[model samples]
Target chain A: MAAARKKETFWSEPISKVDLQRPAVVPSGTSIIDAVKEMKYNQIGCVLVVGADQKIIGLLSNGDLMHEYVGSTLPGDTPVDTIMTENPFTATPALTVQEALEIFHSNPFRHMPILNGEAIEGILSIRGLMVFISEHLPLEVMNLPPDSSLIATHAAGE
Target chain B: MEGLKEYLTRQDFVSSSEVRWCPGCGDYAVLNSVQNVLPQLGLPKEKFVFVSGIGCSSRFPYYLDTYGFHSIHGRAPTIATGVKVANPELSVWVVTGDGDGLSIGGNHLVHALRRNLDMNIILLNNRIYGLTKGQYSPTSRKGQITKTSPYGVLEEPLDPLRIALASEATFVGRAVDTDPKHITEVLVAGAEHKGTAFVEILQSCVIFNKNAWTEVSDRSCREDRLLYLEQGKPLIFGEKRNKGIILKGTKPVVVTIGEQGIKKKDLVVHDRHREDPVYAAMLTKMDYPDYPLPVGIFHAMEKPVYEVELVKQIKEVTALKGRRNLQGLLRGSEYWTVSNKGKTIKRSTGISSLANDESKVMDERIHALLKSTDPLTASLKNTIGKIFYDYDYKRSKMLSPRDSIASAIALFKAAKIECILVGDAKRLYGILSERDIIQNVVLTSVDRDRMPISSIMRPVYEIMDESNSIGDVINILSISGHRHVPIRLKDGGFGLVTIRQILRFIHDTVEQVEKKESEDK
Candidate 1:
């Protein structure tokens, strides 16, 4: 079984990939109520605020909505720019699940957006990563692999 | 301490928030111990403040009637620092769990101890993340399993008492949750200490992580496990006080009081106020099963608190140099004259200037992403875009190409889409569109350098996912200001679902309902 596993490399399997396309963005001036409505209609948990030339300026998460909009004394019509966490942590598509998990753990937020150049491709959540890990790796291998081993291997050659 | 009885009450110390911990949680015992000790301190309840980070034990502030703040995880120390600095008269107490304090908040806790901040920090070492449903905490013993650590933890566990002693906390102590009297006494002593007093409480997480410290808290605790330290008393424990710790060279050896010709003077005498931390750290390292676990104050010393010293320095500096106003400081900087002032220019003109300047364009893209409908997308784009655009191209040799690619993908995922426009600091690269997924290697045929997005004219931008809530989609769109988005499945597969499709669906559903209502009418 060990010899067979060694021969059948896990990396050789075609790992599923997320699309790396640019996503729609919202501007900072958008009202919290309008942003919340947009999120509700779009069925998403967060909105990214960008400037006119399509540079990401800040992030507004569901937590922000819960804390700043629903939980705050401010009117629902308050501008999203006021409560958004400016310059949020970001990651790229090529980042491994392990690297992503570390960032998520160390940082405050549960959800991090994937960036490609000037555009956003997708949002990665801790839950999503966990699901990915459970589906891809066996339960025994979950804690067996050191966190360092899970880091993205970029150096050339074995 | 004589008139302490009339000064405070349990009701005066309780806060308005309803306690939400599970029944029989160790937190209840610790809470009761704290309340029982508060009246003994001869201070008004209003003069006390509780700052707690996120955790089950961090809920201490909620149960306390005093002024308190339920701060973010691992930030109670910072908050406590501010509270102590603001009102030196007020007694500040920081309540944190093992996970909150020793794990995530270790940095803050160590610094707070090192600075000897005038406060009492109670680290409830429950060895699990009780609030988050029993994940392995920093103080969890090696080879312990939990929800997150389904297999035993491979990393070495942190010893809170040793860490405190190492950090030079003026007052360092350890107590157990089961011993209410001892816990209360230690709390009172910690409160009385003028400088930073750090105490570690070994509490059990009974529900999710049960029986973690069973060996230590078992019925044979007195006879077999505990090593209670008292000032000027010999290091002794056991039912008959027969066992005593004696120094053999540098290491401690357990010896009977009246056996092996070991004299009473040979036994180590407790000196908690010793300035040197070596002995205190050694005492803290004593663990159960192998060695008798040391409890009670290990180290207590006097040091100028960070808050007190900061306040004094601030006062002296302020008195010497007059406080400067914000407006004066802002206006003092060199000002530039512009040809056009207060006149709004066309959006096209703004873009033209931005296009000419690469840095300016990069800044604009960052701003656009930040203001996008999706906050996560905007945040991700902004963070990565700024790093890419602002990084010195001359020093680009140091850049990790893999990280760059990963960052780009992360940005795209954060945007909640499949299509992304890859760009260098100077200009846009090939558009990684959804249709480019020709047998998986996306954009495999397209030349990354030569292919401008104008060549790919099939409206390649696709809706990423439909399951995403309207709030999330809007947040992304608002942040990035893009018309289309790409959605994905739970399994990480691609599916295009746009904001326009959602709007259209809602419009159609509403129209259908309205028509039905009119027919019924």
Candidate 2:
């Protein structure tokens, strides 16, 4: 008989796979306030700033809003291009889970946009990593390993 | 002087960790009660252990001077179970909140109680997820407005007391955070109980779930709206003490005293230790606007503690057989060996398998030479080689053909790691973490299940062209406090550069200048 098993599936399986096609574009001249409002309406945390030719330029997250407008003295209507993260990390659809995990560990941001060549594809989240971790690793190994094992090893060495 | 109370002072119980929660959080009252009751029990601080699930209340462990674990979400009971069974002498307490305990951790809570674990579980029901900012919790009343529930909650809320009694909890009680004296009294009683004691404390989340329970919590309205239950006393609540509950047929009926010619004896008396839970369940449901809400011990009974029973069973079995050594258990597993270890196979893909390919091997030798001569070109070549070789077209298509999911996960993890640099974002324009996904989707159990990546992908912070001046990039990074910024290439595609990379670039430039000066000298 088959042993009972907790099914393993992608964490993103629940959320619709995000599309990066056409890349949600905002003009560089658009105000950060308007960008933030667009983000809110879209129910997203960041927006891509684009040039007139629809070429990708910079990225802005809610974090940018907090620093530039909420926390700082800057006006909300300040242009998004002034505060957007310029030239953000890009990944193709062909990237593996291990490669993506390594990038996340080495880089910053809990989420990143997927790019297909110059165009946006979709986004990924840390929850996906957690789901993967939950399936691959035992509960005890998920965090720091138990301290008793270290003590036992020390005794053996002594 | 010889009691546990003598060994502990209110300050002695407090840990050195700074209290970062908002000032008026109900956690303060709960903490005060635990500290006050601990000394009275005369247990040494070393003998006491506190386990907590995640939330504002989960911070209980950090503030306590004793040994504690601020564990992951909704898993405190499981951890506390491990701690208790490992060392039965330690006095264990599990501190949880409405969201942490009732919503996510409900399964663990019920099982622990049913097994009758000897622990005092102080459930602070603030009715909102305070730590995550005002999201409607499982305990948040229907129609309550919250950060996630802009239109108000349409789902029914779980009643903790009813849940506990239904689960056959050995001891069940309720208390108010504002009533410090009563809270302390109930806590001491809960701790003294031999079996699992589930005490639900009606707490206030002043900011997010403001006035959520105002009708029952207000002091002026409490006398009329709240019903304080005591063993052997008539069920009564009123400003003049004129109102009381009496049995009409099988149901509890609220009535006025003296005017109806009904004496206090005619009123329903609370029997806390009753073996049957039917009456207790009824009392929990009585939340009348004009009647006092019931508080105090609703149920109490004796049962064998799960830990003690487990240990007892283990000892009995061990007596018949020899005790097992830790070393033996660690290394005694059976092993298997495979025989087909060194066979080589031909590759069907464009590249020849290592065993069959000779020209491919010569190419690697030349590649190594190029790597040593030009490091940058070698790195780029190596990246492309690795990407091409590792690509799995079939699995990639099945999992995420567009690669949007993986990219989003990468970006979210990056943002969370930089949390110290970026404060909380109350709103989401694009996604940053899995928490954002769970909060926005899974909690509501919405279906985005099989749709393509483009359907869910939100526009995240933009990437700039590599031609963009380093100074301009630095200005954006410093202002946003983002360490990793995606660099958009002029032609297309992108490259990621981190703050560390920029700093390293500057350091490298300075070293180059110093070397040139030394050579000139």
Give lDDT tens digits, candidate 2, residues B160-208: 9999998999899998877888888888889999989999999888888
TM per candidate = 0.49, 0.49
Candidate 1 local lDDT, residue A106: 53
| After superposition, candidate 2 runs with Cα above 4 Å error | A1-158, B326-521
The C-alpha lDDT values of all candidates are: 0.65, 0.66
Clashes of 1: 135
lDDT for predicted candidate 2 compared with the true structure: 0.66
Which stretch of 10 consecutive residues in model 2 chain B shows the poorest summed lDDT?
A: B392-401
- Residue-level lDDT of model 1, residues B196-271, one tens digit each, is 9999888788897778666786655645688888999999888888888998887888888779798778899999
TM-score for the A chain of candidate 1: 0.71
In model 2, state the lDDT of residue A43: 57
lDDT of 1 at B184: 90
